[model samples]
Target: MHELGIVFSAIDTLEEVGREGSLSSISSVTLELGEVSGVVDSYLLDCWRWAADRSDLLRGSELLIKAAPAVSVCDACGRTYPTVEHGRVCPYCQSADTELLTGRQIEILEVVAT
Candidate 1:
């Protein structure tokens, strides 16, 4: 799955960060996940556990994910609402003229070193 690729990419990035900072080991990593990013948490974690253990700096490191809510802004009403609930339609104005404001990102927010 793509989760393995994502995990590998994250680990590569973490390795670069570690090398830049001369870190011996990483204890944890906190990641921010968008609600509509389409990455499954269980798959990500499983991939993380498998791939991270293969890295010297990331073996046993914890991967913590925080969910970010999906938001959409309505052009007709100039209001923001949850994208998951109402989808492309604006709840207040019942208009389809809406754009996604957030919830399509995956970012690493924090890293703890040992």
Candidate 2:
């Protein structure tokens, strides 16, 4: 699954950063997930747990996830609405030209380490 890849990549980045900073252990990884990013947070956390235990640096590491809200702006009305609830339809003018303001992203915000 793609979540596995994402987990591994996150671990790899953490390991690299730890090496650069001489950190011996990692406590947790905090991630910011978009509402419409097509990523399942539970699945990603499960995959991360599995992958973390297999790595020396990440063993016993905790995964923290924060859900980000998706907002889109309507071209016709210049109004913004939650994309997850509206589904690309402008709540103001029912316009199709909606531009995403946020969400649709997966990013590592921080890593707690020692």
Candidate 3:
């Protein structure tokens, strides 16, 4: 799955960050995952457990996931609503003219070094 590749990318980034900061080991990493990001949290966690142990900087590290809700703004109603609940259509005015404001992102927020 693409989740493995995603985990690899995060590991690479964390490794670089660890080296830059002169960290010997990382205890945990906080990741912000969007509700509609399409990347499964369970899959990512499983991949992290597998991959992190291979890296010298990330062995036994915890992956903390913070869920971010998908939000969309409706042009017709000038209001924002949960994208997953209402989708492209605005619940307020039933308008199809809507824009996604947030969500669909996988971001690393912080890392704890030990």
Candidate 4:
């Protein structure tokens, strides 16, 4: 699926960073994942395992994921609620005018080089 493509893109980015830092090997990578990012953690991990081993710089690297909660802000209520639970509706005031404050994120946080 798209996880494989994401893994490839991450590897490419890591390789570029490694080159810039003159790093020969990477020990681990940390990714900050949002609750509503739509990227499955298990699938992403599997893809990482498969792809990381193929790259010289990331042969034995570990992929770590940190989950971030999905939050939504209600315009009418001026309050925040969990996006996964209430979605676009504000649970407090029952308002349909809401916007997502967080989640839907997929980004690299840190990389350990060896």
lDDT of 4 at 68: 94
RMSD of 2: 1.2
Task: Report the candidate with higher TM-score, 1 versus 2.
Answer: 1
lDDT of 2 by residue, 9-87 (tens): 8888889998999998899989998998888878998999899999888899899999999999998889999998998
Instruction: Put down candidate 1 lDDT per residue, 1-114, tens digits, no spaces.
Output: 888988999999999999999999999999899999999999999999999999999999999999999999999989999999999999999999999999988899999999
What is the model-wide C-alpha lDDT for candidate 3? 0.96
Local accuracy by lDDT, each model: 0.96, 0.90, 0.96, 0.95
* Model 3 steric clash pairs: none
Q: Which candidate wins on lDDT?
A: 1
lDDT per residue (tens digit) for residues 18-51 in model 3: 9999999999999999999899889999999999
Worst lDDT run of 10 residues, candidate 1, spans: 1-10
**Clashes by residue pair, model 1:** none
Decreasing TM-score order of the candidates: 1, 3, 4, 2
Show model 3 residue runs off by greater than 4 Å: none
lDDT of 4 by residue, 82-109 (tens): 9999889899999999999999888999
Worst 10 residues of 3 by lDDT: 32-41
| Model 2 misplaced regions, further than 4 Å | none
lDDT of 4: 0.95
Task: State the local distance difference test value for candidate 1.
Answer: 0.96
- CA lDDT of 11 in candidate 2? 86
